[model samples]
Target: MVMTQGWIKDNVQEGTPIKVARIYMKNATLAGDDLFIDNLFIGSDYDNYIRTSLPATPNGNFVYDVEVSKIDLGFDINFMAANCGHDFPLLGIKDATVLSGSAEPYSDIVVYGHPDFTAGTNMAVGRIVAATKPVTGSFELELNGKLVTVAADATAKKMKELVETNLDTGIVLVNQYGTCAGYAWDVEWASKGGNQPLIKVWCVV
Candidate 1:
């Protein structure tokens, strides 16, 4: 037998290379049984809250583009806005879309007599993905793999553009192999030769 003592831990620590989440564990969100609150005066992504007016008919969830015309009520949400931010694109990924109900407003409206179990009359957005496709690009020396992430729900083409933009920006991200080494991708115009520019390769069984 052994004696036990109290201990503590934290999810994040500095200088330890906090790995960005890749394989997310499943959560209650999988059931899509999201929480709901109604009758609020107003909301916006500025404060991590999004505002929306109840449409004539609740269109359900997973909708990326919606035109909210009832702006007279002071609801500043424009789902159809270029990337949808009520005009605040500056927020980028921190905007309303980050929230679960960003697309499915009035999901479970009790005031409307709608039960709280149905997330929306639709499906949740799926991660844009590719299978068995060659990742085209010359890598720096041996760097090959890339962990790309897109905050908003968009087409596969759009996703590629965003990922490329992220790489071109030269933002230092902690890759699986290195830190701040930047994109090892080689370019015919200008780029340093890498170790075959292939960071990683895998065989699907």
Candidate 2:
């Protein structure tokens, strides 16, 4: 009998998310209140530069995110509702509940006070201090838990289709940066209704 390593394979071709770069944090003033990770306070007002804190349940202010003292959907609903198709890219943090093996989809992504997060590299499975967009520079994809400059043609197309259908249910979440409108591209999910072994992002159009 001959032993074969060829039989070994990975669950996902793109692999899983890895922490390549350290997270980038913004300096902030507490506005008369103390802050902690994932606290959802106004790190910079709703415009993403919270200086002072607003009410426990602030309304429509450019303050950080949410007023969930009343379970305010973190006020993220207001942001999404107000900014749905603006095409003006904003920063976001992955929700706390988004641990391994499951994702909360659109609701899982938030605008502010997400432990004061912003865009950068590395989507660690359970890191609250992390981001989801508009990386200050070009980004890469994860293949086998390692960052790759690009994905294979088949892998790129497959990741897009799988995540779109499974996570977004074929709904277009966001476009590939610097591309034409209506292009159906999306972000990576820790798990989109199932386990995805790697950090899959737009390596292809």
Candidate 3:
């Protein structure tokens, strides 16, 4: 028999409005009644006896403390960020169109999503799929094996200028849409694109 202890830190703060929508395991396997779980308790305290102090052994069961926090709200969290505090480096800029292309020369530009709410969900791994400048001054991205392109516009130009001017340092994130638009992508520079320099955005599918 194998016995183990587990603990999970929930993000529902002291005053965050929430509800236990449902309780169900995503996956499970049972054979000959091999696995049995009982005395499962989920609450702020142990047995309502200690309100502030968490008991090391709740109901005679050894407990394990697990560190977990929400990296960002309204986005599908991966295993790392959901269980640990590790967060992926996400590139965020305003009024920018993220695109996708291959590393080869003159690759076909793949455009996905519009500047505002047209592309779709933004809860995936983003990476630099391509760096070649497809247009005058736009960025490209590869998301989920599909090429997504953000055309060079005011936003792209601004981001490029910022990145260039800041000695290639990290840029601040600006969420104008009130939530993550699911444009998980990387950053790159295309010296010859559009009216000015271009910032390429690509997703790592």
Candidate 4:
């Protein structure tokens, strides 16, 4: 096989300003393998910065930084509820039997304390902390777990109410789909059904 060699030379020293004048190839050749130039990084003094515990990019420009907590586009719930368009439709539970000292059949439904918990046999699950009804049709419930915190306190309280109220049930030991509203730590799992990936929030008008 015909072999070829490539070279890269840097003249700038550490802590010195660097500007690339030009890059060129020395002996142009044919009848050999093609030349490939991959991933080019300039002025990347990564190791020295780590060794000295200095800022990685002292001269880097700030492109943009965006921090978003919650967003609500008013939606018509009458239309949504009429068409069953609720992001998380309440799951109806019937004839549910709880085995003593067994992990609940759907521990991930609550999902605050048991983030990594998968449905298994004989695993202890979190307990319901509190349940309250905001309206005639909806309920919210809090279970044992870490609470999700957000930048806005009102948004956090609103979300807590939406989640806890949606799942709040008066029925003795019933399971249903719960919609978690607003920004939360565990909001990644907030959704319409069980055993599915979490989706972004949908608002009701």
Candidate 5:
């Protein structure tokens, strides 16, 4: 797993800019394999800047020299799974789930599922953070875990209503289906059910 934390410096001297600081886990083991850092960025009202690249050095760190000029600060972190590869069939299935109601079906859905069916699991983790003086705003976080399917009739309508109502104030929507796990119909059904992953929206009062 990857861990990251960022905050805006509030006590800078007049005319002195506040730089962004970031730390990442180096030489760490994730899901039984070595992990790699992909990219990092800091965003505010004025600008979004990418931090310097970490050089595969264990316990590596990077800092930005430019001062932050905006009141609301945001940070985004991304990482790649070390040994994961793409499963074309699974990708197609996921696309179908997301676009089930569209007028035209995505062509990618045609290539999913094979008789031999040998595909490795793909996993990704990411986080976005927004900072303020008193943190008086909202932030949205999306988590992908499991997937499921719902009946096209009343059950689907009820599920949609529950998701819209239960999602936190800052969260827009949490979606899952045929994406996280492999070509298992049960996985898809579980994600569509009420017991699957719950998205939490952050609201600072």
Candidate 6:
């Protein structure tokens, strides 16, 4: 279990947006049951403000206040939970190509998207897979019909020159990784008796 609290200082004006500076939790356990957060008070001054019961979702009530006016304001978040059978997963993990570079005038790149599900449907899912290959040789830069010498570790400068000298010039990064793709599924059905909806969702690696 972890208990934490912190404060945030921000500048704003009346009638402006007021961003939430912080959210404090008295007790947070990874292996806890479904938790509910309530009694949230957010505003610039104690006299005039708004209050409500927050949603009981992971990372849901973390941000409570924002710039309501063009003035600086502050608020406090209070919540509690119990130990049960609920756990959160870790995010931000990528083992594939992570490309980042300057965009060219007309170049094509691959993009991906996730699936959308219907409300009260019980389940929703999506998947994406990619593969790459490698090559080794003396890479060269050409201007007009002649090969030009480009300094090592000057990929950016060389690329800019290529684009300027030849409006149709381009740069490409090549590598080899195995093929990767998978399928996902989500299904939900109302349970018999008085039980809630039974839901199942999964993805293949």
lDDT of each: 0.29, 0.34, 0.36, 0.31, 0.31, 0.30
Q: lDDT by residue for model 5 over 97-155, one digit each (tens)?
A: 23222222122222233333456422221122211111122233333532322322212
Index of the highest-lDDT prediction:
3
Which tens-of-lDDT digit does each residue in 91-194 have in candidate 1?
A: 12212233343322213211111233255432232212111211223221112345444322232344345444544423222212111211122223123344
Evaluation by TM-score, superior candidate among 1 and 6: 1
The reply for model 6, stretches above 4 Å from the true place, is 1-7, 10-27, 30-32, 46-205
* lDDT of model 6 at position 117: 25
Which segments of model 3 are wrong by more than 4 Å? 1-10, 26-34, 48-205
Q: Estimate each model's TM-score.
A: 0.16, 0.15, 0.16, 0.14, 0.15, 0.15
Residue-wise lDDT of candidate 3 within 1-205, one digit each (tens)?
1223332235445566567767554214311112334345765555523357654432232333433345565333222121112222333334544455322223333233444663564322243232222123445533233344444332434444445454333343322111111122234434524442344355333
Model 5 vs. true fold: TM: 0.15
Better of 2 and 6 by lDDT: 2
| Candidate 2 structure quality by residue, lDDT tens digits, 88-119 | 22333455332333333333332233334554
lDDT of 4 at 7: 33
Off by over 4 Å in 5: 1-33, 36-39, 43-81, 84-205
Worst 10 residues of 4 by lDDT: 75-84
**Model 1 stretches astray by more than 4 angstroms:** 1-78, 84-107, 110-195, 200-205
Question: Between 1 and 4, whose lDDT is larger?
Answer: 4
Give the per-residue Cα lDDT of candidate 1 at 65: 56
Q: How many residue pairs clash in model 5?
A: 7
Candidate RMSDs in Å, in order, are 18.5, 24.1, 24.3, 26.8, 22.3, 27.4
Candidate 6 residue 147 C-alpha distance from true site, Å: 62
Question: How many residue pairs clash in all the candidates, one count each?
Answer: 11, 15, 24, 10, 7, 28
Candidate 2 local lDDT, residue 102: 32
